[model samples]
Target: AGVDDGSRLRLRGEGEAGPPGSQPGDLYIFIRVAPDEIFQRQEYDVYCRLNLSFSQAALGADIEVPLLNNESKIIKVKAATQSGEMMRITGAGIPHVRGNGRGDQIIQMMVETPKKLNKKQKAIFQELAEIEGNPIKETLKGFFQKLKR
Candidate 1:
């Protein structure tokens, strides 16, 4: 009786007629889009998670992002990209069943933390950490110092 997310469509005289000369009934159609593993739909928008390596995130990269139509798009990752930040790709999402407009794709970034690093990798990371100087504390040190006053 009611429509779902998309625009409602009413087809006049598309249904069976009541009598030989009586007015025909109207056909109401609704579209239901199924859930996808790679993308989650919210209304018409699509959202997906994307993981990036430490180097890829810090150095920036352009990777192929998959879309709903069996297509992939090149998404640009800015340098120093952080986890939990969202990027948007316009018009790359599911199209409205009744309208000509298409939704946008939202990409949630996840910067993978290094785990079980090899001997060489551990050494390099340790050296880099030392050079970076307590990334979190260094950033908050000045702010925390203000709290003392």
Candidate 2:
């Protein structure tokens, strides 16, 4: 039977056999779930952190997330989804040993800003900033121009 961490897996009649015809004592195994790189576990629930690019988060996307079963789940990321936001996929977590259903898959989002921008990329972003009518965009433009001086 599947067991959770710190829980004992019982082996009935597999222990020291009692006197002939008598029931044997039980054997127990301590279950320790090793740490994994992709998933964090709590009981049967599973959690993961996913990174999205600035445009992906802002424009929305369907991301393919790896699963424990070697499968992938497509998560629908809503437009304007912010960093650190969470999306829960029902019945996408670890399967319960005794229960009929599984836990939910919790996705923690991280919006990634580009660390380097090419000239064309910078211009595109500047245009986007202007389109957004953000005052900081103008300030940023002046800052970049000042760097050229």
Candidate 3:
């Protein structure tokens, strides 16, 4: 018997009829692919966020990032690049249909800053300020001078 789109039934002696009495019908099976959380399926590409530390963003480091398959991959990025810069990971996207070719992985860079600073860390920052010539006071003085002008 022919496969029905919704109906479920068996027609005897109607499909591949054999020996004038015995016959076999066609059996259909449906399969579905699960959606991945880490990979977003776009028109022809995938995009995801890759978080980096402040130091990592400043000093450029090779970070170990996670792929959609729950595997770790190393990707190198420029340390001085701006946030939201895209890094393409070749051949790391969803499988293509009709041989159109697989998609690419787009990684959006995100910089994470430190939340808290300890006393020693603050002292170090103050020392850096002194070394940098403490431009804050000079900047304010310049502003007042411009107003007077």
Off by over 4 Å in 3: 1-37, 126-149
Q: Which segments of model 1 are wrong by more than 4 Å? A: 1-34, 135-149
User: Considering every candidate listed, which one attains the maximal lDDT?
Assistant: 2
How high is each candidate's TM-score? 0.67, 0.73, 0.59
Error of 3 at 45 (Å): 1.6
Global lDDT of each candidate: 0.83, 0.85, 0.71
Ranking by lDDT: 2, 1, 3
lDDT tens per residue, model 1, 1-149: 11345656789999778788899999987676565689887767889999999988999999888988888989899999999999999888767878688889999999998778898987778778878884323556788989999
lDDT of 3 by residue, 1-149 (tens): 11213435544545654565656655444433455666665755778888887668878998887776678798887869667889998877766655756667899998876688799976766677789888334677788999998
lDDT, model 1: 0.83
Instruction: Please report the candidate that would top TM-score against the real structure.
Output: 2
lDDT of 2: 0.85
